[model samples]
Target: GAGVSQSPRYKVAKRGQDVALRCDPISGHVSLFWYQQALGQGPEFLTYFQNEAQLDKSGLPSDRFFAERPEGSVSTLKIQRTQQEDSAVYLCASSPRTGRKGYGYTFGSGTRLTVV
Candidate 1:
């Protein structure tokens, strides 16, 4: 894929269920990011991986949330013990890690996770 790809475009999870959301960044992209977007709100950075090295994870809500980019090209965000408060859209984005502005990353359509 030429851009970020996310699976399970929409997921409905019952309370206490665990779910894994997948993301495949553009080939050769060194920077991969995971974000959480609450309804009507902008995406909030969840974690970032720079070629398999997780550079930041401070946005993870709790220990129950985890994200990894084992290959640097693909990533996954997993949520445990799903709660209603966890309902939101999970987004993935990829960049060149150039730290330069104007080169916006490519973002996936996002996975809409709904917990009930």
Candidate 2:
């Protein structure tokens, strides 16, 4: 019955470095999603997985961004060659199932990454 959670609610990174953020989805949830939110902008889907299978990743902004959900319940997003433009809040969410109306997603507070 745990809710979605993300680590290091805030992160500071130097340009060209790599950072990894973690997410733990609610138990028994079948779908997980990652999103990026820039300042004053809405969250944009970055990737998604259903029961360990990544179903969509076209939203990932660049090849430097990668994600994985090896166990279906927990996921991680890793960014290489961090750039200032990569600074944004990385949010994680989960739903009981994908494509089921009314089964809305629950989101974590998010990891705010700041590149300097």
Candidate 3:
């Protein structure tokens, strides 16, 4: 019954560097999602996975951003060649099903990445 959790709630990276953030979803949840939220903006879907299968990733901004859920539970988001524009909050959420409209998502506090 653990809740979603993310590490390095804050991260500072230089331009052209790579960073990897980690997420731990709730146990028994069938769906996991990653989202990017800019300052004062709503969270935008980045990718989603059901168990170990990545069901959707259309929201990934670019090829530089990659994610994986190899074990069907723990997921990671890796950013290659970080840029100033990549600075934003990376959120991880998990739900009981694909239709999260009612059950909603349990989001981690988020990893705030700052690029300089």
Candidate 4:
């Protein structure tokens, strides 16, 4: 595959709504990461996964955020009771491995979520 792919390039949700974003990583990628980028801010790491196992989720803002990769390929980010502050671009990135070696990440175009 070319790189990480995210669906529904843009989404609009009313306050207190629930939204689910999807990500499709490059084929055979072993590592995946999710990040949130607010208006002019940089992307903040939300979670990481190696294969089907979630390795880290320390950056999730609240319990309303959840992510999963069941088959080690496709992943989903779900936000419940979305709020206005939750509006941002959700990015998905994938890499062959996580290490100090010459590894690089491929990021998706990101899903822009708007909460009204």
Candidate 5:
């Protein structure tokens, strides 16, 4: 794909259900990031992967939230035990540089998860 692609632009999950969001970044992007965006707010960093290695996951809200990029290209964000509070947009971003300092990133449209 020419840009980042995310699956299931919209998802509706029942309470306690588990959901997996997929992200396919642009080819050759070394840095991948997952973020959570509450309604009317900016995206909050959730995790970061550098070439298949999870370099930073400190931003993950809880153990139920997991993200991985096995091949450094495609990434997945899995939410176990969905809750009403988990209803938000999950965003995926990719950057060409690993440093990530002042660098621009390409972001996906995001997966909007609604929990009921």
Candidate 6:
């Protein structure tokens, strides 16, 4: 795709249901990041992958959250046993640089998860 593309722009999950959000980043982007945004709050880093390797996952809220980019192109963020507090906008971003420090990322239109 020309830009970062995310699937299921909006998702509604039951409190205990699991959900998988997908992100297809621009071709050749070397870095991918997943972020969580609560209502009226800025996006918080969730995880980061450089190529197929997960370089950092310190920002993941809990064990229930997992992110992967096996082939380093398409990625998925999965949440298990979703809770009401998990309701938020999940964003995917990609950059050509190894780290996000000096480069700007191309972000996808987030997938908004609503837990009820």
Best by TM-score: 4
lDDT (CA) per prediction: 0.92, 0.94, 0.95, 0.95, 0.93, 0.94
lDDT value, residue 110 of candidate 3: 97
Clashes of 6: 0
18-90 in candidate 1: lDDT tens per residue?
A: 9999998999888899999999999999999989999999999999999988877789899999999999999
Q: Write the per-residue lDDT of candidate 5 for residues 40-60, one digit (tens) a residue.
A: 999999999989999999999
TM-scores of the candidates are 0.95, 0.95, 0.94, 0.96, 0.95, 0.95
lDDT tens readout by residue for model 4, 41-79:
999999999999999999999999999999999999999
Off by over 4 Å in 5: 98-102
Candidate 4, lDDT over the whole model: 0.95
The true-versus-predicted C-alpha distance at residue 96 of model 6, in Å, is 0.5
Window of ten residues with lowest summed lDDT in model 3: 96-105
- Report the C-alpha lDDT of model 6 over 15-96, residue by residue, as the tens digit: 9999999999999999999999999999999999999999999999999999989998999999999999999999999999
Off by over 4 Å in 1: 99-102
Worst 10 residues of 4 by lDDT: 97-106
lDDT, candidate 3, residue 95?
Answer: 90
Query: Candidate 2, residues 1-116: lDDT per residue as tens digits?
Result: 47888998999999999999999999999999999999999999999999999999999999999999998888999999999999999999999874647688999999999999
lDDT agreement of model 3 with the native: 0.95
**CA displacement after TM-score superposition, residue 8 of candidate 2 (Å):** 1.0
Cα lDDT tens digits, model 3, 1-116, are 47898998999999999999999999989899999999999999999999999999999999999999999989999999999999999999999885636788899999999999
- Backbone clashes in model 4: 0
For model 2, what is the alpha-carbon lDDT of residue 110?
Answer: 99
The TM-score of predicted model 3 comes to 0.94
Off by over 4 Å in 4: 98-100
